[model samples]
Target chain A: MLTVNNLHASVDGKAILRGINLKVNPGEIHAIMGPNGSGKSTLANVLAGRDNYEVTSGEVVFQDQNLLEMEPEIRAREGVFLAFQYPVEIPGVSNLYLLKAAINSVKKHRGEEELDAMTFLKLIKEKAALVEMKQEFLYRSVNEGFSGGEKKRNEILQMALLEPHLSILDETDSGLDIDALKIVAHGVNTLRNESRSMLVVTHYQRLLDYIVPDYVHVLAHGKIIRSGDKSLALELEAKGYGWIEDHASAA
Target chain B: MAGLKIMQVQPDTMLASGTQFYLDQFEQISDKLPGQNVDWLQSSRNNNLARFGKNGFPTQKDEDWRYTPLKPVTGKAFNLKSAPTSGVEHEDTRSQSALRPIPGLNCHRLVFVDGFPEMSMSDIAGLDGKVSVRSLSEVLAEDPETIRDLLDSVVGESSHGFAALNGALHQDGLVVMLEEGAILSMPLEVVYASNQELTLVQPRNLICLGKGAKAQIIERTVSLSDSSCLHNSVTEVILNEGSELDYYLIQDQSRSSYQVCGVWARQKESSRFSCHTVTFGGGLVRNDLRSEMTGPGAHCDMLGVYSLSAKQHVDNHTTMIHGAAHCTSNELYKGVLDQRSRSVFHGRIKVEKDAQKTDARQSNNTLLLSRDAEIDTKPQLEIYADDVKCSHGATIGQLDETSMFYLRSRGIDPDVARSMLTYAFVNDVLGQIKIEPLRDYLEKALGEQLIREKKLFGQTK
Candidate 1:
């Protein structure tokens, strides 16, 4: 469903991603494990077309279309989702209002009829239940004064509502408690389908325990040094990234 | 006559041509002004006319008037005639449409055409005994002594050119007087519609609320003609002990119109006063709002919101005075400017030496949508008392980049995102309005304005 070939990106003349590459087919989950400053989040942001993350020389294809050439909103309308590590706090735009506008925008781009108020309410209620979010939260400002766990859950709620084809989870488990981590993992597990793909970027192995991935790639020094199955994550957790770094350097 | 003689003696080159024109026109209309036989009223007019002539409209050299220039107002020799011009006769259909009542608001409405109260268009049937609502000209003709003590008391010995001009040239306005313990259930809606081009309309409103009285007023100024006009208005309010008043001024005029408005209020012990000024359409607009808290336990709130586009310019100046102990005041003003429009906000808070335990807070925030749009904000606080809490802050910026990206990343179009954030910036002040219908109307109007501004300046960004 997605392919990245020799993706070299920089920010403000500072190289962050250097000659990186990855591929994911339909219905497959890829877990990207890395140490600090390994360009994991940078890769996710670059894939999402965030400004300031300039793609120096690279090619990203999503469903046979060039993804890097599109605007951020166009990428989003084309079914590319990035769950931010830090959700923005918007004081006046309500969560429900944003959800409606987002859904309608994507639907309009896809030549589908917009959902009425009743249908939208019902659909949003079901999605909110899937993420275990309260009804009152949808009426409040987006992520303003929200707790860490609530913000993460709100992101997942949006993901469930948008139903994007390729979802890039950027450090989604950093600030969440164990209980919230379980709920987020459960929501992701429930949304897993034959046509959906996900790139789970995480630092610890705890999140991988709940939402197991089919492949685990170790990203060190802006490149994926090792590729293996779920067992690589367990090994990295047992023996920290130091062992992998030494082995890759010696190789 | 003495003031006219003094003005005539001054060299023609020494006085601005606009001020010279008004001075010449005042001589022809002074004898026909209302309250001609009343000594105090006539003396007050003469003194203010002299003051206006001496100042000749404030220049940018003045500290308070640094950001605002009166060239547009002073360049034209606007008509000073008290009577409505022939174009706006009683049967004029456009005047009626301009004076239409606010939808969903049930109240006693008084309409004014060219500064004169239109009795045929007003509806104040059930407000006779409970509340005294009369035309200022009628009151001045019948009994000038009734409002002598209240008129011009709030703006005492001021040197503001517009205020002085309004004091001297005001022909007709509204006078609302409430007795002790009286509660006005319905809001008083006053609509001032300008239908004459190149005409100067000065309206003076006097509101006196006795002890424990409560009232709400909605003052709206609109323009019916596309031609350039000038509207100079002054409203003075006196709130007795334990009284409460809510005043909302909505200025939506023609694109070629110039407006200068001032609202001065005085609050007694345990009284509460709140003023909401919402400005939308005008070529050059200036609003001066001042309130003095003279008694203990009194509270005041000054809230405002303005939206401007094109070459529109709006300036809002507010002053809060804490003259007694245990008083509190809060001020918040916000503006949205797009497409080379400009705005200014100057907030001044003063805590007198004897006014201990005073709590005052002020904030001004603005959003500029285009590259050329500009805003100048200044917060001045003079606290003489050591045992008081006063805080002031101001911010001028564009729509937040992170917030924009957040909205756009969720699939909202960039234009829609910009409009949403712009509306949200002003929603803080709109949410404080207690009247539902008025708030709803403003929200709808502001929404339409945002759409219009987007279409006009969407490509500039």
Candidate 2:
């Protein structure tokens, strides 16, 4: 579903991602594990077409299209969704209103009919129950003064509403508690299908217990040094990321 | 005759030339002025005209007029029209006024054509004895003493040049008086419309709320003609002890018309006075609103919203004075500028030496939709008492980039996202409107404006 060939990205003339490569097939969930300052978030942001991230070299292809050539919004309409590490607070814009606009925009791009207010409400109500989010949260400003757990749940709600084919969960589990983690994981598991793909980026192995990944890649110093299966998470959690860093440098 | 003498000494400069033209025009029709037999009314006009001679058109050199240049509006000479003798009715006045009526709001209409009140078009039938509505010219002939007292007591000070000019040349206006303890559920609507070219109309409005009385007054200024015209108006509101007054002024003029309006109010002990000024049109518009809290526990609230497009310019200056102890005042002014339009907001809060325990807050915010659009905002707070609490803030910028990106990344089109974010920026002020219908009307109007101006959105520069 997605391919990154020697992805080299920089921000403000500073190299962040250097010669990184990764591939994800359809219906498979891939986990990218790394410590702080490891270019994991940079890769996620670059894939979403953030303006500040300059792709110095390399190319990214998604669903037979050159993803780097598209604008951020065009990438979104084309089924690329990035759940931000820290979601923005847009005061005065109700969540329901934004969700409706998002759903309609993607639908229009796919040549589908637009949903009216009543129909949209029914759809959102069902989706809200999947994440256990209260209906009142949809009427308030988007993430304005929302708790950390509420923000993550709202992100999942948006992902469910848009139904993006390729979703990048950028540190979505960093701020969630045990209960919120279970709910978010359940929401993501429910949306999994044969044609959908996900790249779960996280720093800890606790999240893997909930949303198990088919493959695990440890990113150190902007390069993927090791790739393994779900058991690799438990092994890394037991030995810590320091072991991997030393092994990579010695090699 | 005395006003004519002021014109004789005029120099060839534009400032003097414009002032002399108005003085000469006033001299031509001075003898036929209304309330001619009343000594106080005659003397008041003479004194105001003399004041105009001392204070000519304000220039950019003045501190208050530094950001807003009056040359574009004051350089030309406009002919002042006389009051209509008979009631004049027009189809446009009846139909155009209904285009943006506040649904579910019970309001009385007092239509003015060319500064003269049209009785036939006004709806003053249901008013009881507690309220009195009459044209200024009618009051001058019927009850000259009361008109003289109202003007003498309330309209005493003139802070700017326009107020003096309006005082001297105003032919007629609306006089609304509410008796003590009378509360009118319906809002008094004042609609001013004109269709003349190069015509200047000065309408004066006098509103007096007796002790413990409550009322709402809405003044809407609309020009039906596409020709160049000017509407220089002055409204004086007197709120007695324990009285409450809600005043609203909406200015939506033609492209070529100019509006310079002043609303001066004075509140007595424990009285409440609130004013809302909304400006959406006119080539050049300026509103000077001032409220003085004279007695203890008096409260004053001033709110404004202005949207300027193209080459239109609007300046709003507001002043809140806490003259007594334990008074409170709050002011908020917001503007949205598009194209090369320019806007200015100057808010002044003054707490006197004897006014202790005074609480005052003022904020001015503006959103520049285009690179060329500009806004000049200043908040001046003067607190003489040590125990008073006063704070002011001002901000001017484009939309938040992060918020814009968040909206766009949600699969919304860039243009639609920009407009939606801009709409939310002004929703803070729009949501404060207590009248539901007016709030909805303004919301719809503002939304259409943001959508129609494609260039104003999606471009941070």
Candidate 3:
């Protein structure tokens, strides 16, 4: 579903992701675990076409199209979704209004008919329920004065509504309590399907216990040094990131 | 006058030429003016003409008009008009124009054409007998004493040049007086339309609300002519103790016209006054809003929204004075400038020494859609009382790039996203309007303006 060849990205003349390569097939869930400053979030942002992250020398292909050549909005219309670690707070723009505009925009790109207000409202109610979001939050301004957990849930609600082909979850488990982690995992698990692919990036193994991944990769110094199954996450959690750092240095 | 060599001529001589021109026009139409036979009004006009001749028109040198130049309007000659004896017989083209009647607002409509009040086009039959609504000409011809008293006291001329000119030339307007404890169920609409070239008209309106009375008045100025015209309007409001009044000043003049308006209000003890000023179209427009809280517990709220594009110029000046103790005032004014348009905002709040426990807040914000578009805003607070709370701020900026990106990332077109954010920038100020239909109309008008401006500039995709 997605391929990254020698991904080399930087910000402000400082290299962050150096010589990274990864591949994900259809229906596969890949987890990338790393310590702080390991370029986990940078990789997610670079894939989403954030302009600030300059791709020095690399190419990303998704759905038979060069994702790097497309604009952020075009990438979104082509079914690439990034659940931001910190959702933007946009005042005076209601959550429902943003969702409707986004849905209609995608529909227009796909040559599909736009949904009317009544039809859109029904869809929003159902999707909002999947993430356990209250109806009042949908009417409020998008993430303005919202709690951390509520913002995370709202992101999942958007993911469910968009139904993207490839979803990148960047630190969605961070700043979330146990209950919030469970809710977020439940929403992700419900959306799992045979044709969908997800790249889950996290610093902890707790999220893997809920939405168990097919493959686990340990990223160190901007390179994937270890690959294993779900048991690898538990072994690393019991030990520590220092053990991986020592092994990666020896290799 | 031009025979006098341009550079060799003294500045005072040059200024006198402009003022003398209006004084000569007044002399030709003095007999046709309202309250001509009244001794006090005649004297008032004479005194105001003399004052205007001395002050002439304000220049960029004046601190209040430093950011707004007057050469565009004052450099040209105008043909002053007197009251039209009979109502205009032209087809009512308002149905096709942008000035549509606000739906669901039961209003008493008054129409004026070329500066003359048209009784045939007005609808005063719905007004209760208790509320007195009369054309300024009728009142001046029959009961001149009432207006004479107001002009001598509350609605007197100010030192502003255009206001003095209006005082010398104003012949027809609306006179609405309410008795004590009276409440108007319907709003009063005053519509002014100009249909002449190089013509100048000054319309004066007087509103007097007795104690405990409540009323709402909307004044809209528009032009149907394709040629250049000028509208110098003045509105005077007097709110007695416990009275409430909501006044709306809407200016949508033709692009070839120049408009200047002045609103002066006085509030008694415990009275409340609110004014909403909306400016949409004009070649060069200026509005002056001045209010004084003379009684304890008086409250005033002033809000404004303006959108300008192309070569349009709009200036807004507001002043609130707390003369008594326990008074409060709030003000918010926002504008969007596109193309080569320019806007100026000056808001001042003064709390006197005797006015304790006064709370005043003022904010002015501007969004520039083009690099060439300019905004000069100043919010001033002068508090002399120790127990007063006064705060003022002004911000001038472009659209937020982060917010723009957020909207674009949702697969929305960049142009549509830009227009939506522009509308949202000024939506809060419009949300304060209590009249639902008026608010809806303004929102639609502003939204269309954003779209039109985006198309004109061919914004980035």
Candidate 4:
């Protein structure tokens, strides 16, 4: 469902993602584990078409279309979702309103009739209960004063509502407590199916225990250095990126 | 014809002749318009009229009249004849003065169309106190004693040319005399409408809130013209000792209708005054609101919001005075400008020399939607009291790009995202308005206008 070839991107004349190549099929959950400044989040943001990251040279094909040419919102409509590293606080805008707008935009893009208020309310009621989000939360202005944990849960709820074809969870596990991590992971895992794939980007191996990715790729110096099954996550958790740095210097 | 000219002319204009108009109108009540017995009410009104005739209106040279030239105000000749619904039927009068009255509000509603009341449609249903609303001519035909006195007590004729013209051509207004401890349950609705035939007409309104008396008022002025017309009105609000007054003004006209309105309020010891104005229309609009905290413990809050599009212009000039010790004042004004529209906000707060412990603050903010649109906001604070707290702020900007991008990334159309942010920017002022229906109505109207005029950039491709 997702493929990257020679993905060379830069921001402000500084090269970030250099000659990256990767491929993923449906029903596959991939984890890109990297150290600080290893360009993990940048790869996530670049894939989401963040304008800050200039695609200096690369070819990224998603669902057989020129992924790099579409605008961020268009990419979102075409089923690419990025759970932000830091959820933005938008005051005076209800969380429910934003989620509903997001859902309808994708639905409209797919040539589907928009849901009315009653149906939308029912949709929220059923989806929100799965993550244990309180019904009263819908009345609040979107993420205005939400706690760290609540904001992440709200992000996952949006992920559930939109049901994007490709979900990229960037640093979603950073601010969550044990309970919140489990809830967020449960939300992500429930949405995973044969048609949808997730690229879970995290530094800590604790989250991998919950989400359990099918493949793990160790990213260092803006490029993937190693690819293996889930056992690679545990190996990196024990040995750290130091092993890769030593091996690269030796080679 | 100068504002200062009225200052030297008829200080007792309301005293000597105006009350006589009301006296004859209510001939049975010989001394004053009789209802709730307030002994000194007649004397006060008489003295006020005397001062009004002596002071007259101001000229262009005055500090307040510097930016706004009043040559167009005084030159117009309008007859101050109070004609009730004498010639027309009650249905015709009420239908002609078509203002929807709020339910459960039982206060007296005065109607002034083209400077005269359609007496047939006047509703003074349950008025039974020293407070009675009457047209200047009607009061003259019935009772003139009270009307003669209180005409020009607070705003001297010499300070404003329009006020002097209004005073010189004065005919009607609301008269409230609280006998020490009267509490009114409803707001007094003052409805003034103008017809094209009236040309440049001036309508004057005077409201007196006696000591310990409380009331709320909604003054509405609209033009009945699809062509050009002028509505120059002066409304005086007097809050006596321990009194509280809440006033709201809705100035929604047309691009061809021009208006110059002034609202002056006087607050005595321990009195509180608040004024909320929503301006959404008019070709050129000017609002001058002045409040004086005359006694200790007096406080006043002035708030206003205006949304402009096309070539419409709305200007607000507010003056708040902390005259006595322990007084406080606050002023806030917000505007949203689109297209080639323009807005100006001038807020001035003065703390008198002897008014120690005065706390005053003023702020003005505006949103400019287009590069061609403009907003000039200036907040001024004048302090003579050494021991006082005063602050002022002003800001002008457009929708934030980062916030807009965030909302758009969340799947909200860029236009809808902008609408949300614009609404939030004005929420500060809208939240201050306590009236639920009017607040919601204004918010919705503003939202619709924003969406209609909102130009989303870089979306076509």
Q: Best-fitting candidate, measured by TM-score?
A: 1
DockQ of each: 0.67, 0.67, 0.54, 0.38
Q: What lDDT does candidate 2 reach at residue A26?
A: 90
lDDT of 1 by residue, A1-251 (tens): 99999999998999989988899999999999999999999999998888889899989999999999989999899998988899999888889999999999999999999999999999999999998999999999999999999999999999999999999999999999999999999989988998999999999999999999999999998999999999999999999999999999999
Q: Which docking class does model 4 fall in?
A: acceptable
- lDDT, candidate 3, A1-251, per-residue tens: 99989999899989988988888888989999989888899899898877688999988999889999988888888888888888888877778888998899999899999999999999999999999999999999889999999999998999898888888999999899999999999999998999999999999999999989999988887878788889989989999999988988897
lDDT string, candidate 4, B275-313, tens digits: 998888677788889998888999899998888888787
Instruction: Give a tens-digit lDDT track for model 1, residues B1-461.
Output: 75553212223323357777888888989887788888999888988899988987887898999998888787777776656565455455655555677789888889888787777778888864757888898999998899988898898877498889888888789999999988888999998888776778898999999999999999999987766789999999999999999999999998889999999999999999999999998899999999999999999999999999999999999999999999999999999888889999999999999999999999999887778998999989899999999998888888888888888888888888887888889988999988889999898889888876677756622
lDDT of each: 0.89, 0.85, 0.85, 0.74
lDDT tens per residue, model 2, B6-67: 32212332354677777887799877667788788888888888988788778888888898
How far does residue A13 in candidate 4 sit from its true spot (Å)? 4.7
Which residue segments of model 4 deviate by more than 4 Å? Answer: A5-8, A19-24, A46-53, A57-78, A96-129, A134-136, A220-222, A245-251, B1-137, B169-198, B223-226, B456-461
Candidate 2 DockQ score? Answer: 0.67
- Model 1 deviation from the true structure expressed as Cα RMSD, one decimal place: 5.4
Evaluation by lDDT, superior candidate among 1 and 4: 1
Question: Residue B118's C-alpha lDDT in candidate 1?
Answer: 74
DockQ of candidate 3, scored on C-alphas against the true complex (2 decimals): 0.54
TM-score (all chains, Cα) for each model? 0.93, 0.92, 0.92, 0.80
Q: Cα miss at B187, model 4 (Å)? A: 4.2
